[model samples]
Target: MLIINIHPTETAWSFVDDTASTCSIHHYSKPIPMETIRQESRILYLISPGQNDLQLAPEEQRTVSQQAPHIQTIFRDCLRANPRADHRLLSENRFYQNLPPLSTRYALPADLATRFQRAGRDALTHQWAWIKAKSILPEVKSLISIHLNSAPNAVAIKNGQPVDLSAGFSQMDGLPGFHSCGEIDPSLCLTLSEKGEPPAAIEHLLAAQSGLSSVSPELASFSQIFEQPESLASKVLSHQLKKTIGGMASALNALEAIVFSGEITPALTAWLVDLLEPLTAFGFIPTSTISCESITRLNSPASRIQVFLMEDTPWKIAYEMFSQAQPLQS
Candidate 1:
């Protein structure tokens, strides 16, 4: 099976053969020749992060592709590269067959970070965290998983499936990311535009120059913020994260677990869980300090809710989810 994950900044492709041999390219440096893939009879799946959660009709697909031309071009080239190979659009119920599409009354916009709210980015960042959260606390009925990364977002899982997300019409709507201002008043954007700031310039500022990094120019990433917990940037991020988690928790009547994932080191996990200890209602009191490991259990055995820290790469998680959802013959 071959899976290609598409993102705004980069593209990644992975090939897993019958023997489970895996080879991959994770940057936009070079393109994979379709002829190599067509040499064997195999399935090729093209995936765009949050798009998998939406069920679109044939016409809707065309509309969405038009809005996201980069994605559309990739799909077109892949199709032409291997005209006879089995190609799948791996979206909506096509992947994660057990999980239903999120329920919402509003019509979803195109999958662009700038135009409207979309999960394509969040799906890449949070889907794996959601899967890891469920695996760690398999029996929890209601759960909230927080992903702190370059493009951070939170997911509310009920009955072991995603039911809600913090991301709004765009990746910029949810929790503030490393550099992007998560949620802000719409009037502020208009105010900037009226001041003669071009739309592209405004986007670059909000999506690239704001958020945690804005608090302290020296702190460029979440990793750095966690490293210097006493820094102004770290303190500001801590305050914001606590508030975001609290708001998400309110949406669920009965919360059982809180899992932390994405671009975190073991020290960051322990530090974050300790900072969030005030939310006693969700059982975050650790019997002892969490160990600095890739995966750690932070809660005590007697707590009403379980707290955990697990780390896994997004690409690995996405490939696993897709492979499991639609297994192909060797």
Candidate 2:
């Protein structure tokens, strides 16, 4: 059996032929280039790993040597351009990279930083190994994971080819990325520091224990808050997402679609669509349920934004990686 994990900045895998042996690792900065996939246009697709979640059709199931494509330059801005820290790489013994950069001089300046460089590299190693195990060559590059689901457009067939309507772009990550408090007033940290809350501790609080968790003690994780939509927690999440989505909408002028994926996607999308205030909710979904059942249409049909809830992003990344590799090997 082989286990593979895909993350925003890394991928990891382990082949258990020798249970006692430790899993080996590999790394790569860029994904298989986009131009490469367009030229070769064939891949040996992998089976859909998701069965319990959203199921892709027989033809929809991920394929190897598939001809898929996407192009939109200004549209490309929608892709994830993470914190500078994510791009940092360490060539010397592979240390001090992949961690979100700490701004000691910034408003909330810190004296020290705890890095996750090794963890990022390890993940890449295992992911590449899985690629090699399948007799694949050339490293995988581009990837788009929403709610951890990476299916291409279900209704995008035209001229016998699927179109990239969304340009594989995503919302602003690290805008309080799940746990991290994206950007905050430096005064809060300074005030905390003045009150004798150690700077490192303050950083820890903001980085790990902030965001949705900061607002409630009962909510253990974002998944819990989104999954169990009962009271203020759900309302709070809905409000936050609304503001974020609204800001994004303003910047883009208009949205064609919205894909919500990851562990919390189902609950997040449902609760948000259901709690779009009464008027706003009515705008998105005309008839919602008491239990807040999953809704395909949260907004009016005329409205442009189409929301989707998906799962299994790791597999999606695998396809993107494989697609990129196809052209190079050919």
TM-score of each prediction: 0.75, 0.44
So what's the TM-score on candidate 1?
0.75
* Cα misplacement distance, residue 71 of candidate 2 (Å): 28
Q: Rate the local accuracy (lDDT) of all candidates.
A: 0.64, 0.35
The local distance difference test score of model 2 is: 0.35
Q: What are the RMSD figures for all models against the true structure?
A: 5.4, 16.8
178-293: candidate 1 lDDT, tens digit per residue: 78887789899999999999999998888888887887888765788788888887777677778766766776766677777755476587577667678765565675655657
Error of 2 at 55 (Å): 36
lDDT for predicted candidate 1 compared with the true structure:
0.64
Q: Give me the displacement of residue 139 in model 2, in angstroms.
A: 31
The Cα RMSD in angstroms, rounded to one decimal, for candidate 1 relative to the true structure is 5.4
* Residue 164 displacement (Å), model 2: 18
24-113, model 2: which lDDT tens digit per residue? Answer: 533334453444223332222222222111112224323411322221221132122211111111111111122222211123323221
